[model samples]
Target: MGVLGIFKKGLTKTRNFFSESFTKIAAGTGHFDDDMLDEFEETLVRADCGLPASSDIIDTVKASIRKTGNDSREAVMDVVRKRMLEILGDKTSFELEEGKLNILLMVGVNGTGKTTTAGKLAARYKKAGKKVIMAAADTFRAAAVEQLKSWGERTSTAVIAHPEGADPAAVVYDAVQAAKARKADLLIVDTAGRLHNKKNLMDELAKINRVINREAPDANIHSLLIIDATTGQNAVLQAQSFAEVAELDYIGITKLDGSAKGGVAIAVAYNSKLPIILAGLGESVEDLVDFDPIDFVNSLIE
Candidate 1:
């Protein structure tokens, strides 16, 4: 499917919720009045845009209505889309420069699809004709290594892994060496998904990052926090917690198809000030697509 199709399909739940609420509000007084704005704000909050973002969106809408003296539903929605785009920002594209080892460190809590995202990312890079390697650094989990290895096999990418109970940093260290030796374009590291409160695990991630910096100083490193869209506001909390420990460069939201709270994407971007690089619309590797703010907002509110 095309990018728009993917967005439409993936955001079905969110679209339905937003559309229904917006239709009801628009159906009611054709004017962007106080009551209409109140309902619109409530809809945004209900869709998991978070309190702050919802308020900001409503304020923007009210300002637009006042400035232009136009309160039609279509005009108000156009203003809403513009505000959302501002919140989402324009840095949606994720690029891997040529001739540099691009290292993406995947971090998040368990059950957030960290491992799967790592694999899918590896596949994506490989399909783009880049030499890719995956590091199974989540040794704390019993089957983490095997699961990553499975993804490696599926994508025909190399996986660097150590035995269970091994130091996760050591796995990353090995992967860095492997990338250097193979002259790979990208090295995706899969770290154990530890709760944000776990100091030891967070420290381990730091250690791995230090290793990457020391071993591959020329590499372009990015720490991406993977989140589940269904978690709603909790996703924002996860981003905040990870931000305290890691230099999160981007966010990758998963399970967009499973929740009506995809508005959490906007909340996360606005609150964290981190660009959403990609979103997992479905289970397939190809389903992981780069985020497009215009397309996302249109899917949600159109």
Candidate 2:
């Protein structure tokens, strides 16, 4: 399916929720009065768009209604859609450097689909005919390492991993060397998904980063935070915590198929100012697709 088709299918629940609520508002008193605006803002917040983003969108809608003197539902919703697009900004594509090794560090809290995203990414790059290597650096969880190994097998990509409880930095160091020796184009590292507030875990992530920087100084590095869209506002909180310790270049939102709170994507983008590079629409490796902001907003609001 195309990007819009994929998003429409993946965001079915969110679209239904938004469309139903909006239909009610349009059927209401049919005026963009203060009470109506308050209701609209509440709907946005209930959709997990975050208070700040919902308020900004409502304010923009109010201004547009007053300026244009068109309080029609279509006009107000057009303003709403425009404001949402503004919050999402532009679509940024993820690319690997041709000559140098590109390393993607995947980080998030446990059960946020971090390992799964790494596996899917490895599969994607492998399909693109790039020599890809995966580093099972999440030594804190034996299951995570095993999962990544399974993905490597499925994707026909080599994985560099160590025994459980090994230093993650050591795993990354060895993976860097292996990528160099094999002349791999991309090396995707899977890090432990620890609570963002854990000081030791954050420090360990910093150490792994140092290892990558020192071992492969010429490699292009991208830190991506995996977020579960089902978690709603809590996903935004996770982004905030990870942004404190790591230089997060992009976000990868997962589990959109299971949640009606896809608006959290806008919340995270508006609050963190980080582009969402990828989204996991379903469980299959092929379900992981590039994030197109216009496609996303259209799917959510249409």
Can you write out model 1's per-residue Cα lDDT over 1-302, one digit (the tens) per residue? 89889989999999999998888886857767788889899999999999999999889888888888999998998888999999999956668888889898899988888988888888888887999999998898768889999999999999998999999888898899999999999999998877745798778888998999999998989889999999999999999988887888999999998999999999999899999989898788888888888889989977
lDDT measured at residue 155 in model 1 versus the true structure, 0 to 100: 96
Give one digit per residue, the lDDT tens place, for model 2 in 174-291.
9999999999999999988778447877898999989999999999999999999999999999999898878899999999989999999989998999999898999888888899
Candidate no. 1 TM-score: 0.97
- What clash pairs does model 1 have? none
Prediction 2 TM-score vs. true: 0.97
How well does model 1 score by local distance difference test? 0.90
- Shift of residue 47 alpha carbon in model 2, Å: 0.8
- Hey, what RMSD does candidate 1 come out at? 1.2
| TM-score of every model versus the real structure | 0.97, 0.97
- Residue-pair clashes per prediction, in order, are 0, 0
Q: For model 2, which pairs clash?
A: none
